[model samples]
Target: MGSMSPIRGCRRTIMMSSVLLFFVGGMSATDGAPPTWTFVTGGRIVGSPVVTETGRVYAVAEDRYLYAVEHGVARWRYDLRVRPIGPIRVSPDGTVVVRTRADSLVAVNPGGGTVWAYRHRTEIASFEHGGDGHVLIGDSAGVITALSATGRVVFRVAVGDSPVTTILRGSGYNLFAATRDGRLAAITDGGARVFRRLFEARIEAMASTADRVIIALSDGRLIAVDTFGREVWTIGVPEAARRLGVAGAHIALISDNAVWFFDNSGITVGDDRFDGLGDTVIAGDGVFVAAGNAVYSVRASQPRAPVARFSSGVGAIGAGGGRVAIGTDDWVLSSFGNAHATSRPGIGARVPYWRTSYDYLFLKDQISAGTDQAVRATREMISRVDRADLAGSYHTIRELLIEVATPRTPRTGRVIPPDVRSAAVRALGRLGDAVVRDFLARAVAAETDPLVMVAIFDAFTDTGIVSPEPILEIAARYLSRARGAELSGEIARAGVDLVIAAHRYAGYVPDVGVELLRRAMEAPFPREIREYALTAARQIDGR
Candidate 1:
C-alpha cells in the first residue's frame, strides 16, 4: 500500500468509487472509466509524454518534431529534424531533450528554441535526467556520458560489450546504469564508479530510489540490491517486466498486458491488467497505465477498479503540476482531469461524483478464488480500503465486513481454511474502529491458528488501533508460539517489527521502542527471539 503523505487538509479525501465517467446518451461507465480528452498529432508518438505543472504537454512524434501542447493546442513545436533514438527526457529546469538518430542530443526550451546540442559518435541507447542541469547518456557501445547543462562533456564510463539499456538517476549526483549483457553499474555525481554487479540473464527493466536499485531480468525475476550492490531479495514474477517504475511506496512492474505492484519488501501487494501493449507512469496519487487506445488510472494507495480510462493510444504517460498527459500512436496528445476542464471529453458536460461500495466482498474472493486476476483485484481493494477512511459508505461497508468476518464452525468432515479465516481477520482490522475492535477482541481470544493471530496483531498497527489491552493479549499469545511451527520465528520477528512501527505511529520517542525491546529481551523467549529482540534494542538505543 502507498504510504499516506502527511494529512494535507482537514477535509477527508475519498478514493473514487470506481473509474469516473459521465453516462452519455446511453453509455454507462465501467470500473475503469474516467473523463478524458485527446489531441490528434501529425505522426505516431514513439517516446513518453510529459505533463508540466502548468498542464503543458511535451512529447516527441516520428514526424521529427517535439511538441509542447496546452489546452488541446500545440503551444510550441521544436523540430528535431531527425527521429528520436530513445525516450524523451525532461530536466528539472523544464528543458526538453531527445537524442536524435543523427547522433546528437538537443535540449529545447519551452519556447521552442534550442538551448544547446551535444554530438556523440555512437548511437544513444538510453538516457536519464539528473537535476542541476546534468544529463546521463548511454550508448549502444556500453558507454555512459555525463553532460553538463550547457552541453559540455563532464565525464564518461565504459562497461562491457553489450548496449546500455537503462539509466536511472539517484539522489544527489549519483546515477546507475545497466547493460544488455547483464551488467549493473553505479556512478557518482563526479562520474566515479560506486559499484557494479553482473547477472546471468540480461536486464529487462530497472528502477531505483536513493537507497535501493531494483532490476527485472529477462527471465521474469525481479531483484532488489542496495547501493553497495548486495542482493536484498529476489522474487519470481509471472511475466517478464517490460518497464519498471516507482510510485510512492510501491514498485510497479509493467508487463505485456498487466501492471504488478510490489511493496518495499518485494512482496506482491496487488496488480491490474488491460488489453494491449501496456506501459506505466506515475502521476500524482495515481499510476496511469497506457495500453492500446486507452489509458487506465490506478490509485497508488489502493486498487479499486481503475478509477478512470481515457480513449487514446497512450504510448507514454507523464504527470506533474496537478495534471496528467498522454501521447498516442495516432499522433494525439491528451490531458485529463479538472486541470483541463475546457477539454474534458464525454459530451463536455460536468459530472457529479457518486460514492458506492463493491457489490461483493473482495477480501473473500482474494482468499477463495486462487486465480491471478481475482487475487489482484481483491488485493487492490483491500489496500485501498485499508487506508481510505471512506466515511460516506462506512456504515454499509462495515456491516458487510462484519458479516464476512463472523467466525463459524464447519461440518465434521471439513474445516474453515486458515487462509480464508485469516483474510476475514485482516478485513476486521482494516475496518479499524470501535466495532472492529470489539470483533477483533473476541476473535483473538478464541483464535487457535498462530498465523491468524499474528495477522490480527499486525492489523492493529496497520489501522492505527493502538489499544494496549489487545496489544498485550496478542503479544502473549504470539510469544507462546515461539518454538512452534517453522514459521514461528518469522511471525515473532514480525510482531516485534509491528510493535516498533505502532510506537512510531503513535508519536512515541525512540526510547519507547527501546523499552519494548528490553522487555522482550528479559523475558524467557526462545533464543532466536531473544537475539532478534536484543538486535532491535541496540538499533533503537543508537537512535
Candidate 2:
C-alpha cells in the first residue's frame, strides 16, 4: 500500500455553451438542446458517472484517474495508479470511494484529498457502502469484510464456496451476499450468518428496496426476497436480465435488447425494445436508459423523446441534483439539465464484403508476400473476415487464416509472429465454420505457445462445434503431462481455458469429457486449473 496522495492535474476540458446541430434519427427531437456543460477525460470512462446531491460529479476513466467536476470544470483528479474496478461510490459521509486494480479501496474526500486506503488480500468481486458510513467488500474467496469510515476492519466472514458476485445492505445493519453459484446469504451487523438460500441459476444482478431484495438470475428469472431471505415472487423474462433498477414500487429490468418495467407484484406493466441499450437508472417517475449514442428517458415503457445524445456511444448514465451525466465511449463526459440533445447517427458501418474472385486473389497475394508488411496485411485480413458476410470465398479466407495460424517449420527464413498467429486463430474461431474445428484442434495439439494454445481453446469454444473428442483428447494429454510437474501460470491458464471449452460440449461426450475433467480436478495443477476442472466436471455430471 502506498501513501494517500491526490494526483493534481487536469486533462483538456472542453466546455460547450451552445448546442451543435446534427442529424436526428426518426422520432428524435430536432429542437433538442445541448448539455449544460461537458467535460473531457484522457481515456474512456469505465463505469457510470456518479453525481452527488450537491451537483458534484465523480467519474473514473481508463487513464486510472478519478475526476471530480463542478460546473463543467474539473475540481480535482486523484490518480489510482491503476484502472478502477466496478463503480465509483459516494459514501454516506460524502467521501468518494473507489476500488482499484491493485486490490485496494481508496477513499477521497471532497477536497480531493485522500482519506484512507484499505488493501485487500484477494480480488474484490463486490463492493458496497452502507448508510452508517461502513464499507462492505466481498472477494473472490467468498469472504465479506466490513470496514468503518476510518478504514478499520469490523468483521470478516466467509459466506459461500464460490466468488461473491454482489453485496447489498438490507434493513438496519443486516447485509446480503450473493455468490457466483447462486447462493444468497443474510448476515447480521456483527457478521453472524442468519440464513442462506441457493438458486438453480447464477445471480447476475441485484437491487434492494426498503423491504425486499430483488435479484435477476442468469436463467432469466427475476426474484424478490424479503429481509429474512424468504422468497416473495419469481417471474421469468424472455431473456437473461443484464441490469436491474428499483424505484418505489416500480422495477426496471434491462436485457440485451429490451427494457421491461414491472410492478412490485411481478406483473409486467410496460416494455420497450431497443438495439444497443446498456444500463438504466431510475429517477423520479422515469428510468433513464443508455442506448446506442444517446440517453433516453422512458416513462410507462415509452421513450419520452431524446434526453441527451453524444458523438460516440454512451457507455453509462447517471442522474442526481436535477442534472444528468453521460460518459461516452470516446472519453467525453457531458452534464445536462433539462436539455434534449440528439447525436449524429452512423456509429456502426456496413461490413465490407468480398464482391468477386479478384478480392480473394488480392488478399491471397498479400498473405503470401512473406514480409512484415504482408504480416500486417494478414492481420488486417483477419479483422475484415471476422463476422463479415462472406460471399463464396469463406473457405478460401478460412484456409488462408489456418495456414498462417498453424505451427509449421519456417520456409525461406520467414516466421509468423505469435500475436499474429493468435489473432488469426481467434478470427477463425469467430468465423464459426465447423470445418475449421478439426484444424484448430490439431493446431492445439502441435501448438507450444501458451497464448496461441489459449486462442485455440477460445476458437474451439467460439465454433460451437459440439464435438468433444478433440477437446477431451487435448485436455487428457495436458493433464497427464502435468501430473508430476508444476505448470507455469500461462500453461495453467491455458489448461483452464481448455477445460471451459470442453464444458461447452459436455452434453456431446459426457462420459469421456467428464472423466477427463474429473481427472484434471485431482491432478497436480494450479488451484485455478483444479477449480475450473471441478466446475466443468460438475456441470457435465449434472451435479
Q: For model 2, give the 10-residue run with minimal summed lDDT.
A: 341-350
Clashing pairs in 1: 19-307, 33-308, 34-308, 34-309, 41-331, 41-332, 53-321, 293-312
Model 2, 11-120: lDDT tens digits are: 34443211111222333443345445455566767888887878788887777778777776677778788888848889867898888764788998888778888887
lDDT of each: 0.60, 0.68
Model 1, CA-based lDDT: 0.60
User: After superposition, which runs of candidate 2 have C-alpha atoms over 4 Å from their true positions?
Assistant: 1-32, 35-38, 301-303, 338-543
Residue 184 error for model 2, in Å?
0.8
lDDT of 1 by residue, 1-543 (tens): 011122123112232111111211211224333334334444567666676767676776665667676664556666677776646777777887877764678888767777788777577787788545788877887777677888876645564467888888753334678999999976555554545678999999887754678899998789998755678999999988888877666777888877788887898888876665665666433466765666566644555333234454445666676555555544444455432112111111111222233434444444344445434543444454554433233444445445444554553222345565566557655545445656667766777777777777765554443335446545655565554555566566656765554443332424434444555565454688878877766654564
- The Cα RMSD of model 1 versus the native structure comes to 21.3
lDDT score, candidate 1, position 343? 19
